[model samples]
Target: MAELVRRAGLPVSAEEAFAWHERPGAVERLLPPSAGIQVAQCSGTIRDGDRVKLQVSFGGVKVPWVLEYYGYEPGRRFCERQIEGVFARWSHERRFEPDGPDACFLEDRIDFQMPGLWPIRSWAERRILRGLEKTLRYRHDTVAADLAEHARWRDRPRLRIAVTGSSGLIGSALVPFLTTGGHSVQRLVRGRSGEHEGHVVWDPETGQLQADRLQPLDAVIHLAGENLAAGRWTAERKERIRASRVEATRRLCQSLARLLRPPRVLVVASAIGYYGDRGDELLDETSRPGRGFLADLCRDWEAASRPARSAGIRVVVARFGLVLSPRGGSLAKMLTPFRFGLGGRLGGGGQFWSWISLDDVLGALLHAIMTDELEGPVNFVAPEPVTNAQFTRTLARVLRRPAVLPVPAWALRIALGEMAREMVLPSARVVPRKLEQTGYPFRHRKLEWPLRHLLGRQTPE
Candidate 1:
């Protein structure tokens, strides 16, 4: 038998640390991205007889592994043993021990055996151990960072938050995150309202939301907008983008401002495109708006929130950078090409791209909600900004693919029209000055970490 043990220090009590694992998305969050593994099915919790099925792909082969939970103990320990999987025998245990009033030590111990036909057991054991170390390290770091983030508002009361674009990528992640942290989430849908407890219907074009339904909310996060990269930006498409953001924001803020009990905070989504094509210039919250349609639209979009601020609401404009996630955004679009080794830099690759992980975006939003001192424009980006060339090279390196080709500026302009020139080629070296000052710890601060995680690229031990 081969045994492996790993431990991590968490800044939360044993109970809290265990509770974090019980929350929805905890499993997904904990799974290392580079493993090429996804949860196929799961039932029950950490309790006895609970089963988890996972699908793992390596090279061209796919395999399914299932494990059964036993020896369950809340806030203490749990054990899972392989019922059907790659290993001939496998058992894993997770233990949480209280270190102090607000801290705990999380321990993971695993024992396994290779298949009987495998001749080189020792070699396989070493490989598995190395992989486990990398995976567990990621899991522990995520847990610690997430716990530390929420610890800032431990004394604050639970809040009811109304969120637009709740069905979108960021919104979907944010709702569960908020609910897991003991806050109530109300989703503002566009069409017919569901029988769900927290669904509210609204029409952005008409500036209409059930005013009576909003009285209970302490915060509103606006994320609904037309996807700019969905297609070529025709004149009509450009108009739609403007209307969706600028008009929709204006309408939403106006409706919220007239509420009998307006929410304390209004968190709206903007983009770094507000800075326009400023070459290599560094930008922050206080930077002047650059010229061009996107920049102008973002400026107008931000201005539309004035009504809410005038009504004594603390409005926060989150100027988001490229949000990296495998599920959606630019990264999703690039995955297929990059995986097949068809990816390369765009337009000389010198344009700087400010980016933040989807996880960090969620964290920043929560930070905006909980942090009263944060108002106005906050650049939601990771500390390190990389040029297009560097980004492509890193992505290529993570995928273990060559990135020798370069897509020229003229070709992009021909293909995507104005969008290629504006969104694709523009350089904005944005910094999260406000977020830094406020001490918002980014979970995936660097580029490679997130890329590896999102792409399931295993790290060297």
Candidate 2:
């Protein structure tokens, strides 16, 4: 096998560098956009025993490859080997070494053999090495720049913002936005068993959070909770869901109350599901929560944060609508079906769907952080709400596919049980009056505009 080694440096801790390397589904993120990389399956931590299946673009052709992580050590090094497909033999090792107090040295060594005879293999190896170098250099520069940015502002006079679920969908996007705008963030990671040093560990079951870790902060944005629609809401699943939000929030708020220097603001995420099945009602911030598992969970979730509010924290409950992104979430799941001409309307298609682009979701979060006047409940949704039919049509149009079929509510109910009724059939025609009242303009006010941008369409003047 031909071997190649490259070294670079970043201005972040060995831990931070390792964290970046170990982010879930990172293979797709690292691959060049031109590569048209689609992750089939990726599991386990990137630091160890990870497996990934990907459809990678080679020139104009797409090739599938399965990669296996053979070895790894946090803040130090990791290695990957191709288990199946494409290359005759492939292996890569990534090393992160501390260079100084705020600098890290990164090195990557790769050995690979292409599927070809000697002369052809040699030529392909040369070309692939060049491409890999260019790509790796870009990645190194990108990471180093990010490290430099964090370093430049890490010590700035700013709010010591601590957030749970800091590596999740909402947190991932919002962290960068917060950092760029001069805020320091600490992740409140859930540790094994009980508590970890320097981390605000919490037991959602017992409603116990490490309150001592919270002190003297400008803001705290709580986005932690179990995903609502991940699985069937069995008795056990329902308990877990309720406990995840209510108990977690209760612990966080209680902890905030104990803080000598409590945060100025506590931005908490709720859901429009609070207004369950609001058929045509133009629900706003003042709308009372409806009856249901999700609605009750949201109500209790918001109520649990009262301790912080009582302690003079500006608690803002942001009720999020459907969040759309090309990268992940519900939209990403639909992309494949829509791309292959299988998209269709759900239920009678009359149920209004209030949605927001992921970028705007982050923007609204940032706005709430910056705007002191934005206290209490705020609806985080697009100005333009559409019916399920409209959403399907728009998506299909964007994908250049046909949306002729209509999924009956009965069928969905039979398949997904109560989940279908709650997640799909219910109509939440929410309006962001509070957000608009504060003059927080939406980056993507309408679905069509953002859809075009996401689908790689250039706007015409």
Candidate 3:
């Protein structure tokens, strides 16, 4: 059998830190996205007798693993024993001890042995153990960061929040963050055929919503919209994009405004598209909107939420930048080619790509919802905006691949049509001026940190 132990000191009490792990979404949060660990089924939340079944992917092949909780000392320790899995034996323990009035020591230990012959078993064990190191390190960092972020807002009352686009990249992450941090989440999905509009609570097609059902909520984060880069932007596809954001948001806001006791705050997702191609100008919330289709769509989309703003709700228009994550979006699409050293800049490589980590996107969203100082057109981006060429090089460096090829602007325009011109190939040097001024602690400020984190790559010398 092999044994491993890791330890860390947290700014929060042992009880407080332990409570974080026991929360609803804590387990999922700890499962690093890059590791490809998915919870198949869960019976309870880290309690004795609770069982969890997981499918851990190994080079696209999923291996089933099952574990049952055993030792459960409240605010102190818990243990999980492998019932059926890849290993011959597996046992994991989480130990937390108080250091001082406001500090805690955390210890994680694992014992396991591979179930095969000597040489093969040793090789597999070595590889798995290395992965375990990275996974645990990520968990520790995430726990510390989350605890700090939550502690800052501990004084604020836990909120009951509703989220649209809960399945989308940002919304999916945001939900887990909110739930684990003690906020209640109510997912507002699109309406289905034959289902009553009131039951669904949102059907932007005909502007129908169950206004009465939204009462007594503390916040609403509206993130529903069509994918801009899902395909070439034909005239029809462009209209779909416009209607999804502009029309749906307008209708959703109208419904929220009609609620008897509407949520105190509403966050509507916009994009850096609000400030179209502004080659090298550094922009902030104070910057004016740019010209073109995306800019116009963004302008109308934000305006569509007028009913909620006019009805006394504190409205936060979040203009998101290029969100970096390995799970989905543009980054996911680029990974394969980049890994093969086929990755290159999209256009002239001079266009700015104001990017933010998926982690920071979640952080900024939570900050926006909690901070009263942030209301209108908050830029959710990193401090530094990298040009397309810079991003290409950085990604290549992270992947240990050389990026020498470049996709010409003309080729992109020929292939993607108007989308190449506006969405994909525009330059917007957007900075999170408002977020910084309001003290929104960014988890990542540079291009490399998040790329490395999301990709599970090691930090360089």
TM-score of each predicted structure versus truth? 0.85, 0.68, 0.95
- Number of residue pairs clashing in candidate 3, backbone atoms closer than 3 angstroms, sequence gap of 3 or more or interchain: 0
* Residue 14 error, candidate 1, Å: 1.3
Deviation of model 1 at 300, angstroms: 1.8
The top-ranked prediction according to lDDT is 3
Candidate 2, residues 115-138: lDDT per residue as tens digits? 979999999999888777756764
Each prediction's Cα RMSD? 3.7, 8.8, 2.3
- Reference-based lDDT, each prediction: 0.87, 0.77, 0.88
Clashing pairs in 2: 216-261
Indicate whether candidate 2 or candidate 3 has the larger lDDT. 3
Candidate 1, residues 1-461, lDDT tens digits: the string is 89999999999999998887766556666776557787887763668998889888878688999999888889898899998888989999999999988899999999999875556887888898888877887788777877887777889998899999987879977876676676778889887676655789889999989766554789999999999889999999999999999999999999998888899999999999999998898899999999898899899999999999999999999999999988788888877888889999999899999999988998899999988999999999999999999999999999999887788999999999989888989999999999999989888878998888666567645
Question: Which ten contiguous residues of candidate 2 have the minimum total lDDT?
Answer: 25-34
Which one wins on TM-score? 3
User: Between candidates 1 and 3, which one is better according to lDDT?
Assistant: 3
lDDT of 3 at 418: 88
